[model samples]
Every structure is written in C-alpha cells, then in structure tokens.
Target chain A: GAGVSQTPSNKVTEKGKYVELRCDPISGHTALYWYRQSLGQGPEFLIYFQGTGAADDSGLPNDRFFAVRPEGSVSTLKIQRTERGDSAVYLCASSLQGHNEQFFGPGTRLTVL
Target chain B: AQSVTQPDIHITVSEGASLELRCNYSYGATPYLFWYVQSPGQGLQLLLKYFSGDTLVQGIKGFEAEFKRSQSSFNLRKPSVHWSDAAEYFCAVGVSGLWNKLVFGAGTILRVKS
Candidate 1:
C-alpha cells in the first residue's frame, strides 16, 4: 500500500560533481519514470523504465544523465559532472502496466551550486 | 512531437465564482489527455484524464474537464471556486501507450480570492 518515494529530500553539491538520486516505486508497479522541474516551470520528462529496462531515454538532456532500474522495483538517476543548470526538483513516478494514471512521489530537490 | 499549451500564465478568481482554465494540445493522433494539480513544494496530483468515450470527464475535488477533439483542447472548469483550489494546473498529452511520455504544458497558476 506504500506509494512511490524518493530519497534525499534535498541535496546540495558543487558543480562538476557526480550525484545519484534513488527512487522506490510502489509495490508491484512495472513502470517507472523520472522528471525534472525547474523553478516556475512544469516538470520535464527525463527517462522512463518498463520493468528493468529503460523503454525511453530520449528525454535525458545529455549523455551526462543516466538512470537504471536493476531489480525492477527501485530506480536511480545519475548525473555526471553536474552543472548548475542541473539544479531542479527531481520527481519520480510509478504506474501499473497499461494504466494511464501515475502515482508520484515527493521530489528530491537537487541544487548544484 | 506532441506538445501542450496553457495560454493563461495566471488567473485569479473570486471564491464561489465560476472558473475555467484553458488547455490546448498538439498531437498527431488520438492522444491521451490529463490534468494535474500541484501545490507548492508538492508532487503532482491527478485531477482527471480523458482517453476515450466521453468528451467530458470528472475528477477529484469537484473538478471536471471537457475534451474537444475538434479544437485540440481540454479545458478544466469548476462551477464554484474555493480558496484551497489555488494551485498550479498542468495539461499533458501522453505521447504513446508504450513509452507513455507525457508532454506537459508550462502550467497555469490559479489564485482564489475571498
């Protein structure tokens, strides 16, 4: 009965550092997604995983961004050499297969200073 | 490339007054539409969605949306506005069922006045 959750409600790091953000999806969910929301802007799609494989990564801004869902229940978003531009609220969501409504988790605010 | 647009950047309405937030989308085919509300420092909450059948859909908190295919729009409306209803509203279009990439509008900020 647990909902999606993300670790590190807030993270502050220097530019060019590497950071990893974790997400625990709801039990039995087969699809996971990551989105980024900048100040005063709507969330932008980052990546999506169907099961353990990333069904779509086109939303990743660049090669520096990567995500993985190894066990099909948890996902980690990786940012390499983070730039100040990467600072934003990272949100995670999960949904049942073939279901349109997605359950979202409280976002992890990442600040690259 | 599917996209969503919310023409109104912000709207303020008196409590108990009728309210409407316009949303327009551009997609190639029959697209899945959604409305979400996000409070400050909170994650998005689904208000309603339109995938088929009915042109009008009902959602939580007395919210409803009408999907007009001919206009490529799905406008959210409520007969009476409440102060708690003030929040950011997003209109999104699901690109496809397989990937389920949602293209969201910039968002419309609603303000309620008593």
Candidate 2:
C-alpha cells in the first residue's frame, strides 16, 4: 500500500561534490523512471529502469549521471562532480508493467551552491 | 520530437466557478495524454489520462479532460473549483516508440479566489 518513496527530501551540497539520491519503488512495480525539474520549467526525462536493467538511459545529461537498480526494487541516482547547473528537484516514478500512468514520489530537491 | 504546450502560464478563477485549462500536443502517432497537478512541496498527482476509447476522460478530484484530435488539444475542465484546487497543472504526452517517457509542458499556475 506504500507509494514510491525517496530519501533525503532535501539535500544541499557545494559544487564539485558528489551526491546520491535514492528511490524505493512500489512493491511489484516492474518499471522505474527518473526526471529532473528546474525552476520555472517542467520535468524532463532522465533515465528509466525495467526490472534490474536500465531500459533507457538516453535522457541522462552526461556521464556524470548514473543510476542503478540492482535487485529490481530500489534505485539510486548518482551524480559526480556536481555543478550549480545541476540544482533541481529530482523526481522518481514507478508504474505497473503495460500501464501508461506513472505514480510519482515527492521528489528530492538537490541544491548546489 | 514529441512536445506539449500549455498556452496559459497562469489563470485565476473564483471558487465555485467553472474552469478550463488548455493543452496542445504534437506527436506522430496516437498520443497518450495526461494531466497532473502539483502542489507546493509535493509530488505530481495524476488527475487523469487519455489513452484510447472515449475522448472524454474523468479523473480524481472531480476533474475531467476531453481529447480533440482535430484541435490537437486535451483540455482539462471542472464544473466547480474549490480554493484548495489552486496549484500548478501540467500537460504531458507519453513519447511514442519508447517506454512511457513523458514530455511535459511548462505548467499553468492556477489561482483560486474566494
């Protein structure tokens, strides 16, 4: 009955640091996705995972961003050498297979100073 | 590339008044459209979705949306709005040929006045 959950609801870090955002998808959900929302803008696709493997990573901005969902339940998005430009709310969502509707979690807002 | 447009950046309506929010999307094939509402410090909540079948789809909180292919629009409407309904609304299209990756428009901020 629990929805998707993200840890560290808010994180603040200095530029050039590393941070990791975690997402725990709903039980029995086979698909997971990550998105980023900047100020005054809508959320943009980042990456997606199906089961334990990432089905699509094209939306990842660069190599500095990476995610893993080993065991197919929990996912962690890792950012290397963060930049001020990376400041934004990171959202995670999950859905049942074959369904178009995605249930989103209260995103983790990452701030780089 | 799939895209969505929310023509209005902001709209204000009196509580208990009818409301309509416009959404237009561009895609090559049949589109999976959706409306989501986001309140401050909260996650996006799905209001409704139009995948197929009937053009008019009903969703949570007494919200409904009509899909018009000819107009390339899927506008959200409600007969009466409550003050608590004030928030940001987003129009999104699920990218075709991919796994339900959504393309969202710059949201419309809804303000409700008593």
Candidate 3:
C-alpha cells in the first residue's frame, strides 16, 4: 500500500546551515535509496535512484552531498555546509526493480549543533 | 571491497531462548543476502533474503536464515524469542544492476531477557 516515506522526522541544524531530506517512494517504486546511520553504525550507502537519474552517487560523503529525483517518484536529500560531521540518521529505501529487498523509511534524524 | 560482518555486538536472549545471529560476507560474485530489523525509531524491516535457490531462508516474524557458501556465512535464526523480539539486527550485502549499494553490518543488538 504505502511504505517508504521520509520527511523531517527530526532535524536540528546549526553547524553551517542548509539541509533538505525528503523521500517518498513506494507506488510502483522505480528503485531509490539513501542511507546513513552513525551512532552505533550500520547503514552507510548514500545515493541511488533509477528513474529520474542518479543511478548512484558513489556513496556521496563529500561535496556537501546532493540528490534529486526529478520526476521519478520523489527524493530530495541535499546538504550544503551542515557539518557536525553531518550528524546522522538519514535513510530511505525502495525496491522492486530486480533484487535488493529494500523497503525502508522512517528516518531523518540530523542534528548538527 | 564489498564487506559485511556482524559478529555479535550484543545478545541477551531468554524470552523464550533459541536464537542465533551472525553474518559474514565479502562479495565478489554471487551474494545478495539480507536480514534487517530495527525497532527504536523504526525503519528497516525485511527479515530475510538470499537471492538463490534454497539455502534455507524464511523471513518475517519467526525469522530464519542460513546461506553458508563454504564459510562466508549468513546466520540469523530464531526458535522462540519473543519479548517483542528486542531490536536492532542487520546484516546486508546487496548490489545489483544499476548501482544499488547495500553493504551493511555492525549491527545485532537483540536483548530480550526476562
């Protein structure tokens, strides 16, 4: 029905400012993903899409990061100067394009103070 | 350098007993295993996957996994365990066509003693 969805579940910027994290992929899902979880560590990969382009952003770790889904469902993920190490928690996933068994969403906990 | 090795970071078991969680991976060819389960804010929840014939895979709720290619491994099991099943248990390794990254590990909390 409706699964993958991410908004501002939680965010607190301050370091340098500039943040945008959004994702809503599920309906028909053309493949999309973005992961990052610090704290104890686990999720890591950081960019991927299959419909509006961005097949992969090579784990975007530097360059301030950037993401866009154009018209392939919905995706935002954009960070410019924010850094406290960029905080953590920022996941989004979707699948059904071949195999990957993805389907996650309920993240967006960035806090850079 | 694909990798994933969750050699237990925490494990308590005792809500009903019987449970194993260990995974190891080093991709280079056939490998797409998975097993996710987070509950502390919630998000990932796919309990099982093995992308091939029957290497013993059964996900969701009861949970089950066993895809041992010699020694690469793919543990995760469950026989009872119920205190709401504790939480945090991840071990992934997926990378299919197009650039679908997913190499995860460093997880495995599950602590349900009582």
Question: Candidate 1: what lDDT?
Answer: 0.91
What candidate 1 gets wrong by more than 4 Å, as runs, is B97-99
Model 1, span B28-54: residue lDDT tens: 788899999999867799999988899
TM-score of chain B of each: 0.96, 0.97, 0.32
> Cα RMSD to native, each candidate?
1.3, 1.1, 14.2
Q: Rank candidates by lDDT, best first.
A: 2, 1, 3
Q: Which lDDT tens digits does candidate 3 get at residues B1-114? A: 888989889999899998999999888778888888999988988888887899999988988999989998999999999999899998988865123788899898989989
The residue-level lDDT of candidate 3 at A90 comes to 93
lDDT of 2 by residue, B41-74 (tens): 8889999988889999999999999999999999
Task: Write model 3 residue lDDT over A49-101, tens digit each, in one string.
Answer: 88888877889988889999999899999999898988999999988762446
DockQ of 3: 0.31
- In candidate 2, which residue ranges exceed 4 Å CA deviation? B97-99
DockQ of each: 0.59, 0.65, 0.31
- Give a tens-digit lDDT track for model 1, residues A9-107: 999999999999999998998999999999877889989889999988999999999999999989999999999999999999999863547888989
As a TM-score, model 3 comes out at 0.34
Model 1 chain A poorest 10 in a row by lDDT: A97-106
Q: Using lDDT as the measure, which candidate wins?
A: 2
**C-alpha TM-score for every candidate:** 0.96, 0.97, 0.34
